[model samples]
Target: MGAGVDYIFIGDDFTGASDTLATLARAGRRVRLFLDPPDAAAIAEEGLDAVGLATEFRALPAEAIAVQMDVLAPLLKALSPRIVHYKVCSTFDSSPETGSIGAAVAVLERHLDPALVAVMGGQPSLERYCAFGNLFASGPDGQIHRIDRHPVMRNHPITPMAEADLRIHLARQGLQDLLLLAWPEIEERRATLKTHVDELMRAGKKRMLFDACDQGHLETIGAALGGCGSDGRPLLIVGASSVAEALSGDLRPPGVAAPAQGSRTEGLCLVLAGSRSQVTAAQVKAARRFKPMPIQPRHLADKTAAGAFAASCAAALAAGENVLAHLAPTEDYRCSGAELSCKLANLVAAILDRQTVCALGVAGGDTSSIIVRRLGFRSLAFEEQLDAGVAICVAASDMPQRDGMRLMLKGGQVGSDAVFDRFVSAMNTKSPTTPSGLWRHHP
Candidate 1:
């Protein structure tokens, strides 16, 4: 119900709403985000007169789509947003259900004028927009600009032509000057990113901006930049969720250290796992011997512990430590998508304010796209479709104050051992780090 609010972000998860709100807020817009399903209690808690649905359509089965529409239709009529922005995923192709767009549009059409609706996808698909010219440019403010202009704004899955017309609508909004930070791809991504930085600096924009395509992107950016914050110290934040999963058998590796406790203290890793089933004395023994290095772990299965862990990771990142966060799915744990996303966005905003570089993330299940787009990278095209496996994404702001972060979503069936090794190896090899850092030994 607040006045002068220009944007209302709705997502199935909190991170998307939070990220979009943060970006728009930084740009001096009055934004309110609704991260959960619209209900009387949630509406009262957020004190908003408007709402946006941020859920990804593909996450639901085709049979459920109609049911979802039945629920959303009334909600749209009740909230009556000036513009209903439906967030889409360029990488999602599960279930052959035509995904979230069609489902969202179907519901919105029942209550609002179709002219008031807009559809947007995150960073992974930035190239899909024809407006991307140099991939690298500098703004007059001495800031690097990765401009994006897409041709599709309102295309439904059922109607392909709506996408083209949507582009015309975007052009009218004066979004042509909108600049985005580009992620490094192949050798050229980094080079292109670096070139844009140089151009921005030459134009008098010397502040390093961060935006990651995934956690790998964050690690890659962190590694390339030598893991130093603006104050010139090594980034030492922990990836609590990943660490937690490791302790819980969700991330078990063959050589992983067993948990250990001294006479006066219990194993920190065991305590973090917080699962009576997963965190046993034997598991603790195994955790103590894990190679590489050990991070402080948290109990993600426990809602209270997970919230605390998320908060702590955010705090560390805000303090300029390189942090990784892991999230278990709703099915595996009690955490909700909206709650997790809100916590992440809050932490990212805090880090940005400190000007300390850090990464924010979520892992496990279908959480990657929701979290990554929340941070504002337009989605990119994936080489292969994800098939009941892990989905990892990283989102970073171009500004050095905000550390680039990753969201790694692994599936239940993926072996924890292989996942951890591959994750660490990938991060170490791709991330730029000092000679004395963990990544230094990586081949």
Candidate 2:
């Protein structure tokens, strides 16, 4: 294989990967996301400028993350992209035990070396910002809180953020001495940004963290990144989908972008919610269109009950009713979260066996990763934007029944309450010819 692709991204989870797919495609670049790490030959056939690999690294232990990376690095090296991006959640969700960014980076470096390992600190589109190297995110109530103080992320079940200072947080995961290019320097020395990083590198810092609040900052950062490495090798990057947002401006043609809508889907859609977040709970409550199927401990623990649950969902879909399968609110179950998620995933697979939906919507970051991986999808292409942080994608698979399936994978904290309604409407209507309001820029 040759250095033919413009960018290669490895997402820590499916939600972020799908968001990046929307980013690149909306920017007018041809991009596809593979559920598994794909080969150069398979990618070349798609005629894409960008290729992505989605993984469940965000929900795995450090040892398991390292093991997955070790298996992936060799194949990634063969892709020979101009930039290798490690895409993380805009919230920077990870911990020393699970989803350790440092551990994954260490394993990757053992196989491929780059001049710099740059970390972009904020994705304003997601209301995640960093100033002076301390990360911040927004609450559903629309308040800006330091990540460690954020209402939901502060108490996230998988990786609760304890420190706002990214350096300290990542250092705890083994990435030490990261040089920060704060907003002041990024603003004051916008023209000499790359030179600033060079000086920082000369001062013994090998890794870099950049602060950005808007598109201008991302473009400036993208320029600095694009200008790196005279050796003609790809720059290795880390951050949210803004990594694509930064680079995409150059690839997009004037006035051309990803469509905001596709001709609305014309049949019943299926939605699965595995996130226990209050935000998702609100969306589920506000929904009036779907036949909600609430999961219980008995439904998963007892095979007969599980079959009844799956059959109920399939019957609803077959009867021309939209379906929303989720956990009941304010209830506790005697099982690990992972076990519950796995059973939910099995139900999705089983339902697909009996019923076919015009489109599928999935909520929750970790759940999206687990279910998409379980479904044996080969690749995903941007179908349309459901909302900020949520994208409707078309899934391609080896199975005829699954190929060309329309999918929307959403992060738990993302989108508006009417997001589900919008998916229902978007699927049954025509997509917009112009791209606008695909995302919101937090000021």
Candidate 3:
């Protein structure tokens, strides 16, 4: 906290946070992500090059996001990193009512008082691109589509992406007046790009968006960003893990850097899917190794019903069968996503209370955040990359039973059809000793 750390990122959810963690750690940078804000002593003790605070704000109302940021502002200020990165989902999933990225930007800008607000608009490594202020992503069907029209995102149960233009989308959330530097501008000479940025800054631009058509664009954008605030003021950046990818640029040469797989253990592997995304539904269906046990929506509202369901999952695990507890895809929930996620977390907690889970997998960002918090994990170290946007993590937890438990978290839209099957196999693959994954801490 004495200013050695160059960057501090506040991730909107656990999955995105770990993606950023992977980007930095794989870059050979010493990084650690905490479940909550750690004290300066902890920061100093970790000898971190970058620190992160993983949050569940992406599932909250705008007012709630503001409240959370108010609590975090002081801790962020204490770290005093050269850059304060506010990491949002790569797909830029949000709405005016919930997970408002614009609202978050406004709050952080006022509190952190950075020289400028720069939003990195693409994560090309994941094949996500931003051109002319529109966001596009590769779909499971092997075609790129505007995020609003993408098969999974268009019909997202919550925060359905109705618009592909980020400027239009964010304006609805009160973040208008953002200046844009298109892909062509990004591809121009570095000095020319700087001149454009300077002109905008001189004209009183506080927030600016840059287009990154590919990984090269992200690096060029990152190289330009790396030179930001050399005048000694901290730069406030916003985006997904690509922000880290951009910042680490040429400093750390890129490589495959696959995450380390944990040594297999002997207990049952449990999977919980609280997401209703088509991607998740397919993963659940294809995960043949696990006995599927779908929870009805009505049962989520009734504790007795939920308990009975948990009992069944516990029974299956005890019989040496890996169980998949998921919300019925066709069932309509009478509760909010947050509420239903809480119910799912409660069920998972109950299962942990009754069974010995050697490995666990949780799908859905909000669900993973709530379940991990309920399980009392204070920190997570990247263990392996189960899929794009999914990281198998080693839990550094306060709960003795859960300490060092191998867990995997996947965003609803992330992973493939066979993702769940692969997760189970990864957990089942035995190794002689704990793999030399990235180092992590609980305190």
Candidate 4:
């Protein structure tokens, strides 16, 4: 059991899953993320220490989330992992209707039935903090703002965060009676921390939150969680990629080493974005090498328009040029978010069916999930860190043409203005005439 994969995670979105992949791999762990639960033979073949399933529940309704988790429950129970992490966004922006974190916790609890369910309070590596029960994150302007007051999240299209106190926020989604171990309490020695945790467990406080304001705090929380698994009761943790970082004992600065150069085959580089986030919009604007093509909401529902759009993109890629297909930054289409995602995915799939691409970049969590699933990729391996929470992965597929395709998945708010540029640069660094190192897994 100790030699097998130590952790199994179900990320709320593809971007979040990739971030955890980066966290574990950078810590020197052999990790792999599957589009679905793989068999024992597949796990052994990959030689993995961690496995994850990428999902788009962050953009789904509560009923939809329940149905999705129901299918995943039995799969998780069969793995018998040391820890099962339900990865959420660091800011924890969710509502009852869409992206219900509590809904997921309840579903997982009913199935796995672990002795304890822990919620890690913050991920410092991403500049997010949890202090005295409130969540704070760095805004796009580099200002520290309470999550509820953060400029971007407060006005987020899908799940706007209106509560700063996580207790209150989660309470809205029907989660209550939570026990919190604040930072001051966490700063004490390991013995004291362990005693306090034991006491809480004895008191039947199965759902608890641990304060994590900095790297040191996260390490302490990590040690506590690591200890629990050794004691024969691995906790069901709910939090961000920081949970992976903590468990792996890797809190070093992210993106420390140069990202591995991607495959540079003589094919087009296609970058697609379904996020209207300011950060993603900036990246789209900065991606000067690619031809920008915007798909309107109306076109998504019309097959003729969608096919035409796909044709244009295919033509662009066939001309030995890159293409950036995205929604305009100013467009707001809430009701059509899912439809637009599917359309974008189908559009990309169609283009890929026509032209060969050296690499593909997907921006937006839901968009990444839909695209990856639609493309029929079975498994992925961590390649490199193209940005803060962004990873370039190598796809393993049964289709020969799409096999070993390079993919970059990014959350809406992650990456810098020049992230798209860096992606193109990564592609250019490799010799177009030679085979790519990304074809083989380093682990």
Where does candidate 1 stray beyond 4 Å? Answer: 1-6, 12-16, 38-56, 90-95, 116-360, 363-365, 368-443
Q: Model 4: how far is 131 from its true place, Å?
A: 1.2
For residue 102, model 1's alpha carbon misses the true position, in angstroms, by 1.5
Worst 10 residues of 2 by lDDT: 434-443
- Using TM-score as the measure, the top candidate is 2
Tens digit of per-residue lDDT, candidate 2, span 275-309: 88888999998888899898887887888988888
lDDT for each candidate structure: 0.32, 0.81, 0.79, 0.80
**Ranking according to lDDT, highest score first:** 2, 4, 3, 1
2 versus 4: better lDDT goes to:
2
Residue 105 CA error for candidate 2 (Å)?
0.8
- Which one is best on lDDT? 2
After best superposition, candidate 4 residue 336: deviation in angstroms? 2.2
Give candidate 1's total backbone clashes: 67
TM-score of 2: 0.92
lDDT per residue (tens digit) for residues 56-89 in model 3: 9898899999888999887877766788899999
Candidate 2 vs candidate 4, TM-score winner:
2
The list of candidate 3 runs beyond 4 A from truth reads 1-4, 190-203, 250-266, 430-443
